[model samples]
Target: MAKLYFRYGLGKSAQLCQVAYNYFEQRNMEIAVINAKDNETIRSRIVVDGKNVLVREPNFDLKPGVSLYEKIYLRDSDVGLKCILVDNAEYLKEEQAEDLFYISKMLDIPVIAYGNRLIDEKKTSLGVCRLMALADDIEKIDMSMPSKRATLDFNYGAMNCSKTAQLLTKDQSLIDEGFKTCIIKPKLDRDELYIASRIGLRKKADIILDLDDNIYGQAEYLYRDRINHILVDEAQFLTPRQIEQLRRIVNDYNMPISCYGLKSDFLSNLFPGSQRLLEISDNIYKMNTVCSCGCGANFNVRKDRFDNYVTEGEQVCIDQGDNYDSECALCFMEHVMKIDTASRKRVRKK
Candidate 1:
């Protein structure tokens, strides 16, 4: 049966987005998202805590005294509105809260309202109070509690940190634990459809993601085939949109994902993929590696086959007669950059 649910907390908008993603993913149905802030501002997208969600303004007027229930009821037949999600519902008046109640109860459309629970430390929001009284289900959206939601973890470090090896081992462990797993890697990293580490560890990837592929769509198909976990190798090549799609996949399907990659390029600039993963991942882990000088490595140094430093080139170059070494900051600056600077000075002098 369709019901009204009120989920209230400090930051509950993400949960609303999750519901919207799931409804569309599972049933191929789109739900209406209503921003109840009564600002008359039309927006194509809403930004919630640095994340973007596509949205459209409701068809009917949302003036201060208008009845939302009547507007939704009148348009239900023409628009086929089966579900409704309310954002910033704390701004809703008591009458509007009742309107949502009637929309859910009489019209038989499910309504989920997300809002802050309190106006202050001691008082509850008026709209939240009315919904709390009228809604069929109420949930406190607490992030501190233990949850079964899928985790997005980033395992990153300099080159040859055993990142891919750990990825292979984790995939095997998950399979041994009876969790069905799928491995994927960016096609930009290699031509083959498999990931191989220097330690002789290799695994065939189920998907080789191209630059423009929709990761969520691909994952939906894999989810239908009973794949529960996803492991990504060389994730540094992933685009920002792809990382957002991975975030959506986990929220909607509760599918765990682990990404292994270098945190930065040879120039010490963060790779776009690694930066995005660091921004949004649930957990961050640094895989440690040692430099040849016996210090902990934190940077990548590029060198030609002749053992001379390749200071500047394309950001990504593979199998191009160049080698990459992990080095500590001091050694990299003193051994590579210092010598390269001297060579440049001599060339300019000539």
Candidate 2:
């Protein structure tokens, strides 16, 4: 049976796609590639087996137009008759994702989507969320490094460091050292900024913030295309309404949608969208980030121009007014207390 495959990971999906492509090509099967507009440009330059293969751009404007399958097949009859391979398949809109899924199922052709599991720096796996419901086969490729001492200035003696340290230590000695040695928690503020930047570079969606213009159109497109599996990135930023729309695509259309993004904000507070995702999502996976002290960094802290911790600030601070770092809850509390003590001393001096 044809199945909608959502392969999610950090660049691992790309490796998997390469493997899958090789497997089919070994059988001398023909493949057609599809991707988002931005990816299509770069994907066109990718040579699979030295065959100048190009991922065609998806035409989102389906109004008064023929179906995507008909359009592609009409342009090149070989695609409809032969096997197809899509790179960066996660960039497809809901309608496009669903359409490809249906083609794989009804036509008995395998449709594979390669994409990141998480969309944010927190390493929340968006691809995993979207694929869990639809995937018949799921494989996790761990591309993370071993946890080590952090470069930040802070104490992390009481923070969590077991899981990440274990990943770093192949033998018992390193693991023992990791546990005994204090490690700093990973900083969330800097990570979120990095994520936002990457999204700016990779996202091809015309409607990034305006849901009515882009999201609804994408949803309607997905319904029309009959997509089987949906893959989404930066899902943490998705509004509650957007999540509901995705849920509707899943429940009403019976399409499985996977999303990736942070579960919480820099301040360790749940993002409105992430909160909804936690409630609605079927499977949850955590990617690891280590604090400067070499411990698991769970909380995000903002800093000012003097590198002093700022507990109260705007939720989104894009301007580089000061530096930021990731710290453990314990460290964050300590900083908070220190700030309070300093304020009290200043009052006394006055």
Which candidate number would show the highest lDDT if scored against the true structure? 1
Model 2 worst lDDT run, 10 consecutive residues: 150-159
| After superposition, candidate 1 runs with Cα above 4 Å error | 1-146, 336-350
Q: lDDT, candidate 2, residue 56?
A: 36
> The CA-based lDDT of model 2 is what?
0.45
- What C-alpha lDDT, on a 0 to 100 scale, does residue 320 get in candidate 1? 76
Model 2, range 36-66, lDDT digits (tens) per residue?
A: 4344432334468987454333322332224
Model 2 TM-score on a 0 to 1 scale? 0.38
Model 2, position 116: C-alpha lDDT score: 45
Please give the range of 10 consecutive residues that has the lowest summed lDDT in model 1.
Answer: 341-350
Q: Would you estimate the TM-scores of all the predictions?
A: 0.56, 0.38
